[model samples]
Target: MPEFSDELCARLREAFQRTRYDADGVLEALGAAAHAALGRGEPELAFRVSRYAGELGTLIRLFLLGGSEPSAEVEAALAPVTIEDALAVGLLRADGESLAAGLDIRPHGDEQGEWWVISDLDSDLLGGEVPPEHVLGVGHASLSLIRATIRRPVGTLLDLGTGCGVQALHGARHARRVTATDVSARALALADATFRLNGLDVELARGEWFAPVARRRFDQIVCNPPFVVGPPRVDYTYRDSGLAGDDASALVVRQLPAFLTEGGVGQLLASWLHVDGEDWADRVTRWLPPRADAWFVQRDVADPGLYVGTWLRDAGIDPRSPEGRAKASAWLDWFADNKVQGVGFGFVTLRRAEVAHPTIVCEDLRHAFDDPLGPEAGGWLDRVAWLREHGDDLLATRFRVPATVLLETVAGPGEEGWETTIRRLHRTDGPGWQHELDELATALLAGCRGALPLSDLLELLSFAHGDSVEELQDAALPMVRELVRHGMLEAA
Candidate 1:
């Protein structure tokens, strides 16, 4: 772990600012193509472009491209922060006459601002398997949790297993007090450097899972846990919890409610097994605490072979190599013995609430949504609360259709002219939810402009369509509730 000190961190931050070594600066220094190539992990173009690009280019090559630079160039690039100080802080090492990065530090930013994140070097760059205690840098899973997390301001927020402190950095933006916990001391050390470099104050705790934050409750919590499912073993601290068969994810979900305040929300990324003769939804939902609302959106499902192969590759192990083949065999055997058929990867959002029957939904939402999901998550919880408040007298509530909701009519050529064959309602925002609507439901929604209560609308539809009011009420209530849950309708 890199030694963290206030003076060293401030000097590094000053060096970064002086050299213009940020996301935008790097993009401009390398141009469009090379910058995009660097993101894809192909750094040849970046190296070629940075050959003559001066101090900023030298910094990028040394830190991001995993390349060595002459001692004089490195010294000039990191001006104001001396070579001896950088080496003492474990930021660089002398490789003959050139200096190489002892740790990987890169500029990462969102709407809040740009900040530097420090972590262990990439295994690919090291040209070997990652060490058992290696800390991970920003990746897809961390970015997903960051984007999916609700950004509403809160009194307190907790980030569990905060590897490299990526999530904690974002949490600090909206939270007044942020507490981040990790089991690995190395991880905590790097996270501390990351926070200090960015000039943010965050509490760092060391312990496995929730041990560090026992008896503490936060208004919001976000975690991207070590959710890989396999035989009981720990090869890497970043991804393996040393628990058997998806229990790591299950343990986090089962224990989350205790750490959240009343009406608090927790969001996390998890993986679950799809065992033979078992419903995945039932298995996951059983982990939820009573009187809590939860939503599980499974983004992808992989068969056993694919699952094992994907994780092996993530560890920088070639699945076709002899050692990788041996590991794969044992992992596959474990899965077969446990009757595991597949694995599901997804995001879980849970809210602690006081209600008789909690709203728990698990579904496969594999389709891509262009908009950020943070608002959708908050809105879903709000809608659930609204539904619970009006459950007894739903017919008395006046509702309005949101402007984003659109009605689509599908027509086909019949024997005579074009005839409408299908009618559907599509939401243009969020996840773009769509539902097929019959004529009666269509008429009911068309009349839901907040002008009248649902009961009066149903009675008017019954009278116009020559149907019994009692039957219409029975049919429309469920549809109205579903629409409201998905943000298609709002209580006026």
Candidate 2:
């Protein structure tokens, strides 16, 4: 590992900014095909297409594609800092008359802005299994968690298992104070470099899980812990916890309440095992502490064979080899012995409340979104809280449908007329959920212009349907609740 100093980091940041070596700029320079090829780990296309000796090309070849470049060209590309300064900072290594990248430094950002992240060379680039202490760069799951996180401005936020400090860095944008905790010292070192290079100040804590923050409370907590399920042994610290199947996630959920302040929220990316006889929602909800309200959205699920193969391929294991075959057999046997039906992977958003009976909503939301979902998550959780408080007085609540809600009617062919077609409400925002509309519900919703109470709508619907208001409420309450819960109808 190479040590980084503040002065050298400042010079390096200056160099990167000068080269415009950011994500958008790099994509523009590489074009679409080469960029896509690079994502698939085939750098040959990028090398062939991006054959320029300019500063940007030289920077991309040396750092991203892991190719050696003439020392003079590199020196010209980074003029102010000589090759000697680059070598001293451990970013470059001299190979005869050429220089090669000694680390993986890349630009990562979202709509907020761009910042450079420094981590160990990717295992794919290395063409081998990663070492135990390998700190990963921005991964797909990390990006998903970043997008899924509710970014309401927080007083103090804690990012547990903050590898490379990506989540902590994001926390800096919306938090007054951010604290990052990691068990691996090398990971913390990379995270420290990431914070300094980006001109961010975050408190770093070196400990496992909540040990470093014991007795301290935070308004918000985010974690992408090592929740991968495996046998008793651990291969990678960044992916596995050496615990039994799914226990790592259970442990995190159990410890969340003690460290969360009143009304605090926690967002986590985790995987849980689905046993033969247990419902996934019930099994996961049982892990939460008392009074911790949560919405568990299962994004994907895979059976034992597929899960094992997916992770094995991730570790660069060849399934045809004897060692790989034995490992797969062992994993299958473990799953069979434990009666594991499947594994569920997803995000869990939890909030602490003082209610005697807490609310827990779990659903499989493998759905599409119109944009980044951070704000939508916070809004939905706030709505859930409101629903809990106003459940008994729902009839008197005035509600309006958002503008994004659209009604679509699908008519049958030929003999069937438009009136016989099915009507549904489609939302243009998150998930794009479609709710089927019956005659009564349709009439009531079409008249919801935020002026009349729900009771009035129900009475009108009852008069039109030749039923009493009480009967209509009995039939419509569940549908109204579902619509309100999913943002089809908002309380005015």
Evaluated with TM-score, which candidate comes out highest?
Answer: 1
**Model 2's lDDT to the true fold?**
0.85
Compose the digit string of candidate 1's lDDT tens values, residues 1-492: 547788878888999999899998999999999999988989999999998789999999999998999999999999888999889878898888899998999999997579999998887877777889889999888888888889999999999999999999999999999999999999999999999999999999999999999999999999999999999899999999999999999999999988899999999999999999999999999888787899998988999999899888888889999989999999999999999999999999999987789999898878888887788889988988888888888899898999999999999999999988999999999988888999999999999999899999999998899999999999998888889888999888
Determine which window of 10 residues in candidate 1 has minimal summed lDDT. 1-10
Error of 2 at 323 (Å): 2.6
Give candidate 1's root-mean-square deviation (CA, Å).
1.5
| Model 1 per-residue lDDT at 339 | 98
List ranges where model 2 is wrong by over 4 Å. 78-90, 93-97, 411-422
RMSD per candidate (Å) reads 1.5, 2.3
**Could you give candidate 2's per-residue lDDT for residues 1-492 as a string of tens digits?**
566767777877888778788888888889999999998979998887667536888889988898899988888777666788778766788777789887788999877899988887776666776788888888888999999898889899999999988999889989999999999999899899889889888899999889999999999999999988868778888888988999999889888877889999998998999899889999898898888888888888898999998887777677777877998999899999999989999988888888887778888877756565567668777888888899899899898999989998777766554444799999888877689987778889998889999999988887787999998899788888878878999887
Clashes of 1: 0
User: Compared to the true structure, candidate 2 yields what TM-score?
Assistant: 0.93
